[model samples]
Structures are given as C-alpha cells and as structure tokens.
Target: MSRWKPHVAINVRNLEQSVKFYQNLFGVEPVRVRRGYAKFDVELPPLNFALNEHPYSEVGALNHLGLQVSSTEEVLAAKRRLQEAGLATFDDMNTTCCYALQDKIWVTDPNGIRWEVFVVLDQEDDRVPDKQKILVEQPAVACCTACEKHSPLANE
Candidate 1:
C-alpha cells in the first residue's frame, strides 16, 4: 500500500515574497523549488501544498486539489481505479509542473473542480532556474498603494 497526502496549489502574485511569508507561517522550508514555483511539504498535519506564480487577474487563489502518492505505479493504479468507476481521467505525464517532473491523472468533479493523483519523478534536472529573473505580477485590484513599510503590508 502507498501513502497518500493532501495536495493544494494556490496562485500568488509574487513567488519569492510568498515563499518567505509561507516559510515563516509554517516554520519549514520548501522541499521543491523552480522558477516562480515552490512546494512545501508539511509534516505537522501532513499536507503537500504548492505556490505558483500567476497573474492575479487570471483566477482565484485555489488552483486545484490532489492526492500525492509515492510512485508512478501508484499514480497509474489510481488512474485505472478512477476510470473503472466511470470517471473520465486525463493523463499528464512527463510534465514539469510545480518545478518537478511528474506523472499525474486528473478528474473533474461535478462542481467543475479538478483533482489529480500524481507522483513526482526521481529524475534530477540539473539546470537551476535563476530566481532573480522571475517577473513579479501586480495585484488585480488596487491595494496597499499608500502603506508604510512596517506599519502595514508594504515592502520591508
């Protein structure tokens, strides 16, 4: 049997800033990192969450939900099991998402929410993405236009 953990992906305006914020909030460092992406695996309550850099005008905070399995075999098994139950499964294999190579299967719920069962590949990618090159996106709505650095939410 394979272990399963909850996976949550959220969109953020700035990846570098958000990563720092989440690190302080969770008191843990992200296990995975790539250009504009970071994955935090928390052991306290057992959660696998990721932050993705995206435009605020694109969508809401939540990107999707999923179960993080141990291996590709488990992912394929989940795919078959899901399909056997008559749910349409979409395969996304050898894809570099959230900064890692992954094999995942997606299924949409009745409410149009998507869920995936995925496994991160052990293959190593040597090309490290330069963090300084990431472009920051602005908030969709006008916010904190005139706030001080330490008083409220502002550049510190």
Candidate 2:
C-alpha cells in the first residue's frame, strides 16, 4: 500500500451492470457495494476502480483508460483472458499510439468507456521528444482518441 494507485471514478447508467462487468474484467468481486455505487479495489493492477450509478447518458470525450503492462506477451495474455471471460476484445499490435510504439488490447465497459492494456515498445520514441510541448499542443484526449473511435466496440 506504499506505492500510489490510480483512482478512476466513472459514472455509469446502471450500477449492477457495471459491477458485473468489472467483476469479470478484474476477476474479483467489489470490496464494497451499495445503492448507486460500487468499488473494486483491483490488486494486480493496483487500481481504485469505482462506478457511480446515475442517469449520465453522455460519456464525454474521454479518450480512454488503460493499464500499461511490460510486454507483448502480457498484452496477449490479457486478450486471451478477457476473451475467455466472454468479453470481446480488439487488438492493436505494434502501433504508434500516444506518440510511442506500443502493443495493446482494447475493451469497452458496459458504459462505453474504452480501456486498454498496453505495453510501450519504444520509450524513447522520437515522435514527440518535447513531452511538455506535446502536452501543450495536443489536447490530452487526442493521444488515444482515435484509438477508441476506431475500435470495434465504438458503438457499444
């Protein structure tokens, strides 16, 4: 519990549906659940994932959410596991995304939020050397924005 874990709280249309989706995705039951809310303290990825039940119809222009893994094998493994769990997955192998070469798999939550488990193949990618400049020029969402739009689950 020493290292910082990323906390993501996304609004969902139905708490129960989201809870079931996450349970299959993370392979763990939410540590806490209540009316209009649910929380899964994912251990393997060290994420504080939460869902808020609301009448939130607009998903906003969120580019996506992701888990950065260490290798292509790991990415493939995730694809296999998720697919086996009856979740459809999309693969983007050796693509230059977020200005870096990466291998990743994409999945859409019941709420239409795109999630990716990716591995950066080229950390020193010269696409955007000035990290701060990239941040200033490109809308943060632009990084992987196209990735989600082109995903098979884009409509889902």
Candidate 3:
C-alpha cells in the first residue's frame, strides 16, 4: 500500500439505524447513501468509513474500529456530542486502555459494533484489563514452562 487514506467497511444489521447513529456521533450527514449502504466522508481527516446492511451473526459482532483524537479536549468534546445525541457513553478518564494512556468514550452502534473515540496520552507495555495477568494466574496450558516460553507479539 502507498500510504493512502484509511477506509473501513462495516457490516450492519440495519443500515438506517447505523447511518443515523454515525451521523449523530460525527455531527455530519451522510455523504452518500445507497440501497443497503451509507458513506460518511468526515472532512477532518483521512477516514473513509462506510456501513452496509448484512446478515447478522453472533460470531462477528465487532470487526474493529477506532478514532484517535488530537487532544484530550477533542475526546471530551466527542463525549459531549455523543451524550447530547442520547447515545450510551462509557468514559474512563485518565485510564489506561489497550496499553495506552487514554481518555475515551465507548458506544455500541445498532449493529453491535463497538466504537471508540480516544485521545492517547502515552504508551504503555501492556494491554489494559491485563489479559496476560489473567492468563498467568489461571494457566490453561499443560506446561507452564512452554507457556512462558511462548512470547506474545505486540499489538500493531
């Protein structure tokens, strides 16, 4: 890839509901609408995101998406916008999440996809919620020595 813009194609259960939720959250109208899809070309950055209606499945609820803000103020502003839209907002102020110093708001869209708007303060060495600790505390492997030998890769 030649370092171009980023685009995300998400599967949604209801196109109308997802479009409305995204429009309210981003404070913008959909740039394009199709039979089973809606596209929002947010002008602030190079994010080209779209949602399409598809058959729902429990195995694939979230296909991964995130928003990285420039500053903490932006994070708070996003939270306020989400709250004003009457969306569910989960805030963890000055908390470490995904191994980064972040303040963010969490909301699930109509398709059960988690959306995260976050401003990162700093980087850390571990995933927040500490999965490794849980794994170590309750070792499910047959050999603890082999388990310790398998070093996990870092999240890209």
**Most accurate candidate by TM-score:** 2
Full ranking by TM-score: 2, 3, 1
* Candidate 3 lDDT, 35-88, residue by residue in tens: 998999886666788988888655253333568889989988988898898887
Task: List ranges where model 2 is wrong by over 4 Å.
Answer: 125-142, 150-156
User: Candidate 1: misplaced stretches above 4 Å?
Assistant: 1-60, 123-156
Which of candidates 1 and 3 is the stronger one according to lDDT?
3
Which scores higher on TM-score, 1 or 3? 3
Predicted structure 2, TM vs. truth: 0.80
Ranking by lDDT: 2, 3, 1
User: How many residue pairs clash in model 3?
Assistant: 0
Q: Tell me the whole-model lDDT of each prediction, alpha carbons only.
A: 0.63, 0.80, 0.69
Superposed Cα deviation of residue 101, candidate 2 (Å): 0.9
Error of 2 at 123 (Å): 2.6
- Over 1-156, each residue of candidate 2 has an lDDT whose tens digit, in order, gives 679998988899888888987887777999999999999999889989989998865778676888888889989988888888889888888776666778998888887888898998864434655763433233355466656665545576
Estimate the TM-score of every prediction. Answer: 0.43, 0.80, 0.72
